[model samples]
Target: MDNVSQITMFFLSGLNETNNHRFTLFFLTLLCYCVTLLVNISVIVTIIMDKNLHEPMYILLCTICMNGLYGTTGFYPKFLWDLLSPVHVISYSGCLVQALVMYSFACAELSILSVMAYDRYVAICRPLEYHSVMSKQRLIMLVCFSWITPFCINASNIFLTSRLKLCSQYLGRFFCVNWIIVKLACFPAQTTVNGIVADITVVIYTFHGIFIVLSYMYLIKTCANSIENRAKFMQTCVPHLTSLLTFLLTGLFSVLIMRFGSKDFPLTFKNFVSVECFVIPPLMNPLIYGFKLTRIRNRILVVLTFKTK
Candidate 1:
């Protein structure tokens, strides 16, 4: 009845808090889910049908769109199930697979952003070499690494977790968060929390630090050098800034709550931030690029007005 010993069922209570909130959340999540699918599908279709967007940036956009596709789907399925079925039960195997796939996409998306950063880095920092650097073969290699590496990491993490015996009380976290589900398994480790911290730190440094530095470094230099550079810089930089600010603000709130606030505040805000990550990114990416990018706007307008009559 404690933390350890063989446990089967785990209960999660995020999206099912109150009747009114639950109904509101259900519709909200459903609306977000629909928008997520539509926006991403629109991007994917544009990339496929339009020969002009068969370029590297759009290619990465398509890949990120795929990750959003998986992420939004992974979250709502359980929420919908819980909305209908009061039990909200997930089998051990089901939890593992869900966690694996969820993290796979999460890590892949992170990697895609980093690779996209590098793409931007090369494009701006070394404009002459951008073509040679991110050639089709190289793009293929980057894409391969993004998907393959994360799949292995999360797959092993989930596999290790599956071996442990946990009580049925936890029922899995409200979401298919890999670390939470793994912790519930009660696998004996020297430092599970420290391991997660180290892993996240490494990820942040790898993707955010390097890119942010390189991005702004190139960004700064370009701005300083010429007025002609300003327009193109403004175009690409906006998406990065939008995503960056959104990510930083959400993460900042979570960190402040965890570090400075009381126990209740931390949990309350942490859950909010988790939803921000899950729901916001998919929605934001579309808005950021769709409105800002002229090509996407033109393509969208074209697609919307076409009747094939």
Candidate 2:
């Protein structure tokens, strides 16, 4: 307990073995972060600048792009700096904030996707009620719900983490996460509440997964009967599915690796799995929505052509 009180920062050992390849990794990471910014921003800017995209679906797409920016920003800048420096360390407070941002960003994403599923369900299943169901007031509320609920949930976890006496000042991953911090607690009893809250959080998101699955099941069944509905499904729902799959598969791997990863596994491989969620989704979700959606694609083309002239 005295040692924990004296601790001021954590040493991130994830990058210790990469010293031999630091410059190459730095260049690559810098490029990835820049491209992530460019693509996500382009999608967000296109949607915001073009008033024709003021519909519910486009607004949600914009929100997704904005979130990609939020999540990546929380990690990339610190990571890029660590790549350049000899030491990989973060202050206790900074680590907590990063954990909060990363987890909240993830949970908020699933929440937004759930909302998107509802949007599609209304659009396809109850066309007449789509407008009434997704009115401006309602959309605003849903957006708030998506971001806020996760923030509060993760905030509670982080608050619990803040109270613990951490026996270790080292984290395996390049970035901090609540679970890793919880695992460092000096006493097992200290983590009981943390574990309970985490389980509840998992249950909450599991139900979100169930809701999305049920929504899409109905969507697929309905679309099967009508050619027009099938076309709409291809145009809109496919991109959502791609985004959802990318987010879920990457997140699943991260969780599995954290919980069950063998010590014999190469650090590089484990690091890659842990960071893949941050890398892939931010870069791909915008591109998927930008090119896959007709309005966004055409608007981007028009701007590019106008610039060329």
Candidate 3:
């Protein structure tokens, strides 16, 4: 047999159990993907067109929806195709690209959420200086940091994974993931650097999570002293908290599954766990923000009514 280094394609074994229901799954997945696009695009377009909604909060919400679209685009199309194809395979380069997109998308979400926390912190806890603190220039910089930092970090991780020679071409999951690819390294020693970098990436994002918590702690304490602040907290802060909890829980579950999931678990269950982050947050974030924010909700309703007429 030729060396595994010569292997240019990987077989995804995660779909093996679902062959009998491929068509049904394909329709359902396509429907979900369509809805994801519709909701995300609607929120994005509503924000873009409504000049009055161009404040920092709405802009950040728009960023979140844009990120939702960006992240889900990386997964849904390929997944829809794989659902119908008998051979679930991807080329080596394609696999790395997918890993880059998937990881960066997840990382960027946390980064953006951290920025949103800061935006909220300034708006509520220090209302007098909210505009100066979250100026247009600063918001642009923060958005760029959220997007670019994650891309670079994940790209580095994928580059390290790319240098290693593989001993296997069959990835058990439905999609390519950097950690899974790392597991296929020809030698255990080859992955020491990858593990170290992965740890650092984890630490960076872990601190992002910590910063969010502390920011909210201060937010809660500040809001406690006044009914006006309490009303503001319920109106603005709750949606961000909802989004943070949704993103964090779903992301954490996916990571846990990757790191500790049992092979004995049903493939169906494992597949759901792997994809819950992609599914829930993309679909829910826009809806949560849209209905929760009165301006967005009113504008969206106006747009819908205008369209209907």
Candidate 4:
């Protein structure tokens, strides 16, 4: 195939593709995106404006909220447009930008979650030094890395892919994930595979793995220390455990799909997991925090009431 023939613009073959279904999906996703915005924004504003929530914990949550906002922004707008206009083809440049959006937010979220895990570990295991260890400078440094690491990889992948020859026109997925883009490219892929493996190793093998181990260690230490209020600390940890499980499982599958799985997996569990990365983490992080910590819930309620004022 000629270079011109090899490359073509992609349409996000929607999951629910019928005309009526498109309208329904547009409204539903619109509602979700709107609500997510209101909630995350409220939390961010509250944490910033209210002195009560100016602590490291709430600052960390603000970072988490920012990730959620960007993630959802990266995901739903195209689907919404496809619904409204029935014209779903994305340009080559658009697809490349979309991949960058995905990489940027995904990397930020993974790193932020790792930071949160460490935050909780320090709070639980080293309460005396929690403030010292997670000082404002340290927190700034952590969030700076969260934002930087993702785009660094994003730049590399986009730069390399720009030079490749594309052979497969069909990239067998609903959205524009990088691996699907690579699958359609008619280029030698050993370098791509190595890059994928290295990304996973940096995240899963190096950082996330360390966070999980430290979290479990913190849990054990907390349990030992909270002899009188064992139930309280355990109850506090229940939400974190749930959040950690959901985040890791969804993230792991996303990496797995890019690494080893076929595109057809999207017709099954993989699609659900892909959606989970955007839909679940944002909703769950706030909900878990609200449920476990009365302070955040009350703060959210105050923020909501203020909005409706």
Candidate 2, residue 260: CA error in Å? 0.6
Best by lDDT: 2
Kindly list the per-residue Cα lDDT of model 2 for residues 1-309, writing each as its tens digit: 442435579999888889999999999999999999998888889989989999999999989888889999889999999999999999999999999999999999999999999999999989999999999999999999999999999999999888888888999888998898988988988789999999999999999988998999999999999999999999999999999999999999988887889999887679778978888999999989988999999999999999999
Task: Provide the TM-score for each candidate, comma-separated.
Answer: 0.85, 0.97, 0.97, 0.84
What would the per-residue lDDT of candidate 1 be over residues 1-309, giving only the tens digit for each residue? 243335555566553444456667678778878888899899888888999988888888888787878877777778766766666567656666776776676567667777777787677768899889989999989988878888877776665565555534563236555556555544447336536754764575466546666677777687667675667678876676676566556545644643455656434345555556666777777778788878988998888888553
Ranking of all predicted structures according to TM-score, beginning with the best and ending with the worst: 2, 3, 1, 4
Residue-level lDDT tens digits of model 4 in 263-300: 66545355545667777777777667766777787877
Model 4 global lDDT (CA atoms, 0 to 1): 0.71
Q: Candidate 3 — which residues are off by over 4 angstroms?
A: 1-5
- Poorest lDDT segment (10 consecutive residues) of candidate 1: 1-10
Total clashes for model 4? 0
Model 2 TM-score, all chains together: 0.97
Better of 2 and 3 by lDDT: 2
Q: List where candidate 2 sits over 4 angstroms from the true fold.
A: 1-5
Which residue pairs of candidate 3 clash? none
| Candidate 3 lDDT by residue in tens digits, 1-309 | 332356699999988999899899899989988998999999999999989989999998999899988889889888989998989999999999988988999999999999999999999888999989999999999999999999999999999888888989999889888988999998989799999999999999999999999999999999999999999999999999999999999988987877788989887778779888988999999989888999889999998998899
